[model samples]
Target: MLKRLVSAWVWISTGLIALIWLPWMGLVWLFTARDPGRYSVGRWFRLAAVTVTRLNPFWKFRTTGVQIHDPRRPYVAVANHESLADIFLLSHLPWEMKWMSKDTIFRIPVMGWMMRMAGDVMVIRGDAGSRMRALEEARDRLRKRVSVMIMPEGTRSGGGELLKFHDGAFRLAIETGSPVLPIALAGTRHAIAKGSWLVGRARAIARVLPPVETAGMTLDDVPALREKVRTMIAEARTVLQRELAAAGA
Candidate 1:
């Protein structure tokens, strides 16, 4: 009981601070921009998130299987969506990656501004025109050697079970000939869950599976490629669940 109370307080406070700080930092980055060679500003934004995570007592992030991300090439990375922490956790990845998030997130004060500055793609769910625009922007980013991270599951899952992924991400990979990086996140469900503020500590693991090359693969190969990605991520999901069970809930 005491642990839950402390966790809630810590999470609320951290959110309030981030609400103010993220936008301020965004404006600062805009007026005093220095590094222009970067296509994705994820590295810089991640540094800020790391500081907050270290100070906040609500929960912590753990990672494994990082050696899979190659620093040399851009990748189209996809992962399972379990909780809001998925965003911050993915930022911890070593590669320079961009997120494809909801269009409304860009309307937020600091968070949205920073996302724009970072070149992250935003989508208005269920709107055909908006989806098309987001797809074009994503393709352009890929062509310029910027890796985009997307949650093909589209939204957070209530049960942590694997959800169906859309064909958009796979289609983009086939069109651009970029390798697809399949990632699986485990244990985040316990950190901050769906429709709940209650928090708890869990041993979260991020597994970056080997990249599935799309170099010679054509549009006709998307179906097979999607199935392969689903299998790889599911393997990691099983490992994560087993680890959680071994930890005794």
Candidate 2:
């Protein structure tokens, strides 16, 4: 209980600080950022999130195979959603990717405003018009060579297992002719469980698998593409668990 309190305090304090800093940074980004579509100002918030995770005595975050340095080659990055901590853990990767977050997240005060300034896509679940607009925005981002990150599961699993993926991400990849980058997240479920505020100590791993190209693929291929990427991430998650265990051993 004490540990959870400490972790929770760290997160809350960090969030409060972000509420102050993010908006200032957003203002600066307007003057300095080159492309509105590829604006990376929100990365400041993501970096702050990384710092919060690092300051928490209960969590260790790491990433692998994420050396996508080419600015010209944008991808449709998809990952399994295990816990809310997955967002911060994935941000540790070197490259930048626009997140396709739920519209509700975009309603949060400073954080939401930062997301808007960063050109992240937002979708309202069960709202077809919002979904279509989000898709169109994602496609436009890809065209501008900005990679987009999507959690295909639509929600956190709160467990290590992969949930059934939605078709929107895969369909977006097909429509944009972008490569699908499969990312596997392991151990986040132990860090912060869904529907709970308690935080726990854990080592989280994010593995970036090889990209699956959708150059010649069509809408008819979305289901197969989604399943294939889902399987790859699941297998990679299993491998990551073994690696984490061995490291601890």
- State every prediction's TM-score relative to the real structure: 0.87, 0.93
lDDT of 1 by residue, 114-136 (tens): 67777788899999898889989
Task: For model 1, state the Cα shift of residue 61 in Å.
Answer: 1.6
lDDT of 2 by residue, 1-249 (tens): 797688678768778777777767767687657766544565565676777777788889999975787855789999999888898899898777899999888998778877877788999988999989998999998888888899988887644567899999999999888999999998888888788778877898999999999989999999999999999999999899898888881
Backbone collision tally, model 1: 1
Residue 55 error for model 2, in Å?
A: 1.7
What TM value does model 1 have?
0.87
Best by lDDT: 2
**Cand. 2 TM to true fold:** 0.93
